[model samples]
Target: MISFSVDFWYAGIGAALIALSLLAFLLSKRLLKKLLAFNIMGSGVFLMMVGMAQTQNDGAADAVPQALVLTGIVVAVSATALALVVIRRFALASVVAALAAENKAAENDAAENDAAEKNGAERTGSDTAVSDTTVTDTALTDPNLNKNGDPQ
Candidate 1:
């Protein structure tokens, strides 16, 4: 009679995980998902290494592969942390760029509106009446004012 053992199951699971990792890495576009797939593939490799180290007759596990797996785990963790840092920096840079673009666009629109108002006043031959309801930006009046509307 043939017997299926724990090593057999581990090997099967490891193979499946590796296959899934490849698929995930290939199909996913985001950095986080790719990192997760890489971690999964590493785990699968570790499991396979352990499974292969199992002795057939004595059923004893080898120490070398276990040590290697432990070392690999540490390296993987370090790599993941570095990758996360890089991703965060990239995300921050993207946000800063987007905000800068938005601020520039707002300044341009304000300039155009001011120019239009001046032209309209010139065409009508009269000074435009400043309405009480018109609210002006603090930046336009006092250069010393900070972004939070606080005096510098």
Candidate 2:
């Protein structure tokens, strides 16, 4: 007749797990910080529910809570997967957009350099208070060109 009374232990474990889970959810952690913490919280909740079931005089574990935990874990996995997919998509799109902008600038610069080769006078003089490049505000790189087709 030396059976242990697991009621107090089970209750204490359940309370601790619930408190920790809430703390994990309420803390001001960055959204992308890590996913391990969320998984740990889910585990804690599972344990807490299981421990609650154990608090009863029955020494055997129940099946309902275990099944619930399985379902919840599946749902969590789906949500995490979707979130990761979205983050990856956004990161890729940002990189592509930046590359396209750079490519456009390069094309513009090449066209200006070609015009300078064909029309030397428009790019190489400072005889006035404002050369063509300065008059049109070229300042090393220009978005507009003079009638002779050189960047200004």
Local accuracy of candidate 2 as per-residue lDDT tens digits, 42-143 = 666776677677656374677887789789989988978886886566456434433333443455676675554443333433325333533233322232
Query: Candidate 2 clash total?
Result: 0
- Error at 25, model 1, angstroms: 0.9
Query: What is model 2's C-alpha RMSD?
Result: 16.4
Native-to-model Cα distance after best TM-score fit, residue 110 in candidate 1, in Å: 9.2
Work out the TM-score per prediction.
0.67, 0.49
Best model per lDDT: 1
Model 2, position 49: C-alpha lDDT score:
74
Which pairs, if any, clash in model 2?
none
| lDDT for residue 36 in candidate 2, whole number 0-100 | 46
Instruction: Give the alpha-carbon lDDT of every model.
Output: 0.63, 0.54
Runs in model 1 lying further than 4 Å from the true structure? 55-58, 109-152
- In model 1, what lDDT does residue 108 have? 59
